[model samples]
Target: MSDTLRIVLIVASVLCLLFMLRKISQSKVRIDDAIFWIVGAFVLVIISIFPQIPSWCCDLLGIQTPVNFLFLFMIFILLVKLFYMTIRVSQLESKVKELSQRYALDHMDDEVKQDEK
Candidate 1:
């Protein structure tokens, strides 16, 4: 990687790590959600400090360059996160629907008794 790219990656990763730490301390983000950002920042810092890691990965993956490998790595990580988020959202939607139906059933008799009065 170029000097500029290395510097930017290191700076950005450190900033990200710090931001995640602050958020965790404030209870702004769940540990599960923040885990990805924390891990990604560490991976980035490692690659930035030792550029040969990406260089070797590029050769193994048959990617044209180290930069391409880095981007692919990031995108893969994001895609996995997105998939998990989708699954979680689906589970939440089903739970909400179930709770709403149960609530309506539980209250139906009360509504009828009030109307009868």
Candidate 2:
């Protein structure tokens, strides 16, 4: 319930959401994957915002009672995953663009040949 814990959770949730949105906007995710990630993000936000949830989890896991550590750990993980996802999306986009350009060039050559005939 400290200010730092609250801030950490908020920042992590925001970063995860923004990352996901960016990928989706870039056409990285299909409809089903988008839905799944959206739901997962929502769940993460809910868990981060509710301190009691972490407290309960700690109790169940027989871990320490400090939710701050949990928040920090979760944020770190989310950031790493975001970075990985962004890199993958960028690579896929590049591949798609490259393939599309190659196909268009081939089609254009075929059209030119037909015209010459």
TM-score of each: 0.85, 0.47
Tens digit of per-residue lDDT, candidate 2, span 10-102: 777678778888987899877666765666667667765787877787777777764654766568777987998899999999999999999
| Worst window of 10 by summed lDDT in candidate 1 | 33-42
Give me candidate 2's TM-score against the actual structure.
0.47
The most accurate candidate by lDDT is: 1
lDDT of 1 at 95: 100
Candidate 1 C-alpha error for residue 34, in Å: 1.1
Every candidate's lDDT: 0.92, 0.76
Model 1 alpha-carbon miss at residue 7, Å:
1.6
Best of the candidates, TM-score: 1
